[model samples]
Target: MDASDTIVNEIEKALKQLIVICNKYSLSGSLSTVNDLDNAFPSNLPRSTEVEFLYKNYNPEKLKIETGFTPIKIHSVSELSKAKMVMSAY
Candidate 1:
């Protein structure tokens, strides 16, 4: 399913408090707001996968290098623009 569908399903399940999902960025322009809870989040927590995440949003034509991240074009807002799985310290 698409990002929106996944979000809706996950949000419903989130009410159970099984896990905490932190949506870092609204990569897709379609997601205007999340009704479940406040989307405001603190930045720069710390991680190792940042390079991979950055690569996804990286600009091409301007720069290029080996082991480059494949460009993920978001044709539609419903489509998953991007997603990052971050392990937070609880």
Candidate 2:
């Protein structure tokens, strides 16, 4: 169980969540399996490990930055096919 293993699990989890949100909102979007997750991502990458939210105030031209920590995103695979498998009555 190396780092990439954990990251892969997280990526899969995120993909599932994304698919759920898309279904809930009736959004059509999904990347192909190969394109969804690159095998190279598991290795050293240049992407950030956290999300940054920038706040700007027009009152006095002030800016504030907030960072939300998150686990590293190493890999992802499409969940569209899996999610669409669930039958619906409509």
Candidate 3:
């Protein structure tokens, strides 16, 4: 969800990572953190719809127990970014 701060932060971090990767390859690019919410969604769908969409969740406990596949645990943005960056390297 674009409205989610976590998602936004992850995107920002990913952009920064791309900059680093590009620079490593001698490429030039820029990243803008500004998120223009006005153009992010259809005008008919208000901001509240995004918030509700973000908050709506099916319980994850059952899936975890049944599948025995625990999701990656990230307590902070830094951890999430690091995990994603590491995963991306492969």
Number of the top-ranking candidate, with TM-score as the measure: 2
lDDT of candidates 1 onward, in order: 0.29, 0.33, 0.38
Q: What would the TM-score be for candidate 1 when compared with the true structure? A: 0.18
Candidate number achieving the greatest lDDT relative to the actual structure: 3
Would you give me the overall lDDT of model 2? 0.33
lDDT by residue for model 3 over 1-90, one digit each (tens)?
344666656655664565576456554322222244334334443345423332122111111111247543321211233545677799
Query: Model 2 over residues 49-89: C-alpha lDDT tens digits?
Result: 21000001001111112235652222222222332343232
Ranking by TM-score: 2, 3, 1
Considering summed lDDT, which 10 consecutive residues are worst modelled in model 1? 74-83
What's the distance in Å from true for residue 81, model 3? Answer: 32
Clashing pairs in 1: none
Candidate 1: lDDT of 50? 29
How would you encode candidate 1's per-residue C-alpha lDDT over 9-86 as one tens digit per residue?
A: 565464233212212331222213223211222133232232222223221212212235674332211121222222
Clash-forming residue pairs, model 2? none
